[model samples]
Target: MADSITTIGFDADDTLWQNEQFFRSSERQFAAMLAPYFDGDDLMDRLLAVEKRNLQYYGFGIKGFTLSLVETAIEVTEGNIPASVIADILAAGREMLWHPVETLPHVTETLEGLADRYRLVLITKGDLFDQERKLAQSGLGDFFDAIEIVSDKDRSTYERIFTQHGDGPRHAVMVGNSLKSDVVPAIEAGSWGVFVPHELTWVLEHVDEPVSSSRFRRIETLRALPEVLAEISAAYSAA
Candidate 1:
């Protein structure tokens, strides 16, 4: 038997770099800004609701999130939200967009270690411009053989990407923080799904773990990736 995995796909936000923390920070600011308008209302929940409803219209990323914040503010205030407040909200969004990328611990070294051994791909879902900006600033762009900044992640998307970039999902491994977007679908696509949990993952992205799948593996961090891959290879070779 040959090696079970030949290609590796990585998720950008949270997995490779700091992402949801910024959103969390902005959300607290949004809630504080809206607090004076209405007392005891869960503004964060309202914002998340708007975000879910508007995902079709705006997709993901700071721009969409900013629009949702403004919409939530107006709705909560019954169209009485101040223009200055709205300006402040927009400014917050701009600040998030301009925020510098900070790669997670072990990301750079792990990517460098794996780059020589596997066909590496960056597969992430979000606003194209924002994703590209993060990737460019990450200084890890050259490590990947291909970069996929998709609108969403699904089994079909994984199948298409892995097949096109490598030998297909059977020979691929997708590592990321989201169980919904990164792990489950990649497993459904017949690839190994490596889950590396991130503390600040978005609530909407949460899903039950696919623990029963033989192709599924969970690691504490990206630093353990090579060891896990070796284990997978040995297990496959034995069978």
Candidate 2:
């Protein structure tokens, strides 16, 4: 797989920088903010449902999440929630957008090593403005030859990104944490999927096993990525 892959696509949020954990933190704050009306657990359940339902309409990222928080507050509390609470939710959303983009362990060095060997791309799904801001702050942005802030991570989306970048799906390898977003779709699109497990993945991105796929594999961390590529190259060379 590594020998065939000339282009490597990375999923930004959790794959590269700290994203979902901050959202989780903000959600905890959100639950606490509305503690007067509903149980924290119940609020979490309700908010998650709202977020899932709103994904199409609001799309992904902080703004959509903030709006969902407001709507969930209204729904669970029957619109009796205070304006100050609404204000606080909006404020929290802003804070999340402006939060420092903390690169994951070995992300910088990994990208640095890969950049010279493959055509690197940042293929992330989120609100454009927020994604762009985070990319700029991440300091690892310069490594990518192309950047894609897509609305969703689907088969067609992966196909289109590879096409636009002039990289055939057969020669592309998509790496990320989410099984649903990064692995499955890339595999379904006829590309290779490399799952790099993250300890704190968002519930929304969870999916079942990639059982039957020969083109799919998992590496424990970013530090292991280069060796995987090297192994692929070596195996193909020996053959």
Candidate 3:
């Protein structure tokens, strides 16, 4: 018998609303603030390196990103970096924290349509307060049956979330823009992994598509989600 799907897991950043663009904007601002001390591309490379290393220390979100920026500045300048630059970086991070949450095309409509049919669970990774702020600001909070703000996304994370929120990983569908964080791990956890590509995914979140996975489905936008879900259901029933 085919396993029945009962839960739908959605990713917030970029999948439901605009997120990475703000970080990109802030990065350009950060580069300009330090141009006198470092080249733009070189500074960005250093900043990314620090971010990668600092993920274990600071985790994800604007706060960690700002800290990484400061660390990068201090490293490149050999500790002579100005306090004013650091202040500016902190201010930029605050701006990102307060930035408006602009939902992607068809996000609201699609979620509204699916909420009645499935147990919708939001699974996102980032700082707790910032993610909470974004969810409150987005006004999409009510549609979710449960919200999980985790430090990271992985197979075990999906297993736990799906089991708690609905049925189990085998009965869940995880949809998002990142192939790495949102897709691969969820697929490994025994859920359907649906990829909805976004234009400005962060470099660290990059990963190749799992086209050979029977549970993988790629859609152009959230508008196509219901149809995809129906198709998955049909496949499951026929199995």
User: Which runs in model 1 stand beyond 4 Å of their true positions?
Assistant: 1-3
What are the per-residue Cα lDDT tens digits for candidate 1 across 1-239? 15578899999999999999999999989988888887755777888899999999998889999999999999999998899999999999999999999999999999999999899999999899899999999999999999998999999999999999998998899999999999999999999999999988899999999988999999999999999999888877888
The best-first sequence of candidates by lDDT reads 1, 3, 2
lDDT per model, in order?
0.93, 0.88, 0.93
What are the per-residue Cα lDDT tens digits for candidate 2 across 197-232? 988997898898697997787998999988777765
lDDT of 3 by residue, 81-192 (tens): 8999889989998899899889899999999999998999999999999999989999999999999999999999999999998888999999999999999999999999
Per-residue lDDT of 170 in model 1 = 88
How far does residue 199 in candidate 3 sit from its true spot (Å)? 0.3
lDDT for model 2: 0.88
lDDT of the structure predicted as candidate 3: 0.93
- Comparing candidate 2 with candidate 3, which one achieves the higher TM-score? 3
What clash pairs does model 2 have? Answer: none
TM-score pick, better of 1 and 2: 1
lDDT of 3 at 192: 97
Q: TM-score rank, highest first?
A: 1, 3, 2
